[model samples]
Target: MTADSSLLAQAREWHVLLHSGRATAADRAAASAWRCTSPAHEQAAMDVERLWALLGQLGEQPASEPAAAQVRPLRRRRSLRWAVPLASAALLVLALWLPQGAWMSWNADFATAPGEIRSVELEDGSILTLNGATALDWTISEGRREIRLYRGEADFQVAKDSTRPFFVEAGPARIRVTGTRFDVDYDGQDVVLAVTQGQVQASDAQAQPLLVGASQQVRWSGERLQPLQALDARQQLAWQRGKLVFRAQPLSEVFTELERSQRQRVIFLDQSVRDLKVTGVFAHDDPQAVLRAIESNLPVRLVRLPGLLLVSRS
Candidate 1:
């Protein structure tokens, strides 16, 4: 194997060992020493770790029978100690090489690539405006209409269809409405529902249904649904117009939202800097310029690199 490929393989091994909850002090020290060997080593480790997280969010499954059968041989042949290493390596390789469109096409009825927004018209007269990096599917049958928000955000303008109640399932929560305009944003963990017109009822795993009126928002996670808060729904949905508005939010969250607005990944190298609050209006057309503006105001430094943007405390 090439030197770079060898480094990536070693990085994957280190990643699995460290996260296995069985790493000894010596193992950690060895991993640290290996990372210090070269910048390439450190980058490889970081890339693999991030890719693992991304795959988890994208619902990565176990290896297929053929792939599993390949590992079975390493167990039988004691001399070939490549199973564990190859497993993690294979996952990282798939993450790196898999066509993102294929992954989305397999599951999502409709999806938008990173930095791309789209609009869809349901079988009913309802309209959906998907935000960047969003994926959703809908089922309409037997006087029932349901939409599932698998990732990212979307704004819905429901058609007045009282016969078939409209529902949106996001994460661990559900929003039920009949002919109402609202926005749903699922960030893998929490689902935020913002109503622009009319009202909707929201419920999560641990909470009863709650009513949310126009210009109000509610957040739901696996735990419970939060009480409604008043906010400008139009401002929240400004991403539809290539703009983003953050009101005294954490720098980390700002960067996270910025990632959804663009194609590249953003990494916060300094956790302490992330807690810094930021409030600004950013145009999504130029993410790099937005980062530059952030760096000018905050006590953080930004490093622009291909495929990754690194943030650290100044």
Candidate 2:
């Protein structure tokens, strides 16, 4: 039986809250009562738990191998281990998974794991390049072609078909184009569109269609589209070439990208350090090198932990 979307959302929210360190006993009691409301609610909660279990096993080795042989050596020489509690680890996983629509990722036609960049050739001769941790679903019919980007970023080199238009639904914005090359980045809260070739029409839930041409980009958040800004489209899309170009961006923004490409969680202990300006072109393949450079140039220190990295002000 299919669970209602609203019920699934509620179940996911409750799961995250229960796992979060901030949840109180009262919250747990309330969540239990919520699950008792209906059989659908209970099933939704079970589904959420099942998904969490699957996520936990993503890093595990095959069961055919002996457990003793599965252990691996630590990458860092520093013996400093942050005493992260079991609850905190669960919370961290949920924090990283939920925002990317874990449900959608599970059902996506195409998905790339963290730190994996993949290219797919469509039946229509279009080429799709998916960035790390991205998930998307697509359908190409005789009348039209539609792509729903649930999370992360993708570059599309659409094949020319004058009789059919390509439509991409990303967060609050929808893009319609015909035989164009463009990039779309959607991180749950915001949607960014950059056109590298030809022109595309982008619109949000409440905004009119905005024409974005080559070298132009626009951002959509809270159902509103920001003004078009001109940029070096090639520079913005350097990730396809194994490079990341940052120009005076916030340290938090830089780490977000690193988290995708490195498959590691980075937590900022001090909020003030997140706003530090960072500018440089770094190789995407060497996330540790980039972190070392940031540590050297910025007034910050790094603490390596198992599956996580902590940053704080010096």
Candidate 3:
């Protein structure tokens, strides 16, 4: 491997060991030897360790970020009591995990306030429209453009950067593009990608590419991808407009939509109505309007309680 490639590989191994808690005594000694060999090596190892610490605290991260090591969340495993025991020696070995690395700055984060839409002017002068209540992190470093969506969503009007392909990550999927106008909906396990113009490819961090075209939408369920034709692209991205638009959308999808809009939380007493389809644009501010619309059309009942709303099949 080349010098840069070798360093990158070592960096990745260090990261996996630090997070997975799967590193052995031999591995640590080798890592320590590598860290002491050169300043660059030490910096790389410390950087990865620190990153894990910070991630445990906030469940968010970015490139070149200073990591906090003072706080490490306990590995949450309900079945840990049944696992093999490692005794005191294992605990003592981990005691040397000194807190190291730089603390990241707030300025490194890209956030948009609720009900406020912001546009980002990229280095290439291309515009990115950030929808309300969005938090994402991106970097253009070492001839690579990377965008990691920690939370919320973004509408990209990508400028062509063939030299450094623009990439957006949401949940388990990464979107790669040369240039395109697309909307990425990242709701944890499911990432719904819609391309209005140009083209983009969706894949896991290490998987084959799935090309998406104009007026198309696809979702990644971590293990596999399902493509759906754009029957209602507007509804797919109504959050950007402060509205939830549905056109003969399934009743289940409607409840999901209502849950997204309700300030508190909407609960459905009946799951049977979830399969029924409803069509309309419901103003987000007063979700009661949508309920009323649903009431006027479907054979259903709406029950409004303190801080919660319910949809039931009549």
- Provide the TM-score for each candidate, comma-separated: 0.67, 0.68, 0.55
Sort by lDDT, top down from the best: 2, 1, 3
lDDT by residue (146-183, candidate 1, tens digit) is 99888889999998888899999988888899898999
lDDT tens string, model 2, 157-266?
Answer: 99989888999998898999889999998877888899989999999888889999988999997768999999565567888888988889899888888866865567
TM-score order of candidates, best first?
A: 2, 1, 3
The best candidate in terms of lDDT? 2
By summed lDDT, the worst window of 10 consecutive residues in model 3 runs over: 96-105
Reference-based lDDT, each prediction: 0.76, 0.80, 0.64
Residue 183 alpha-carbon offset, candidate 1, angstroms? 0.5
TM-score of candidate 3 on Cα atoms, chains taken together: 0.55
Off by over 4 Å in 3: 1-108, 111-116, 122-126, 205-207, 228-232, 237-243, 259-262, 283-286
Local lDDT at 51 for model 3: 38
Candidate 3 all-Cα RMSD: 18.5
Name model 2 segments beyond 4 Å from true: 1-90, 93-104
Can you write out model 3's per-residue Cα lDDT over 1-314, one digit (the tens) per residue?
A: 11232453476576668557888888888777877888777666655455344334332222332356223442234125323222222322232131111011235367654334688988865677765456677788657888887655678988887888898888887788988899887644577888989888888765678888898888878646675666256677777667878877887766654544443234455668877888787665566788788889898887543223456787
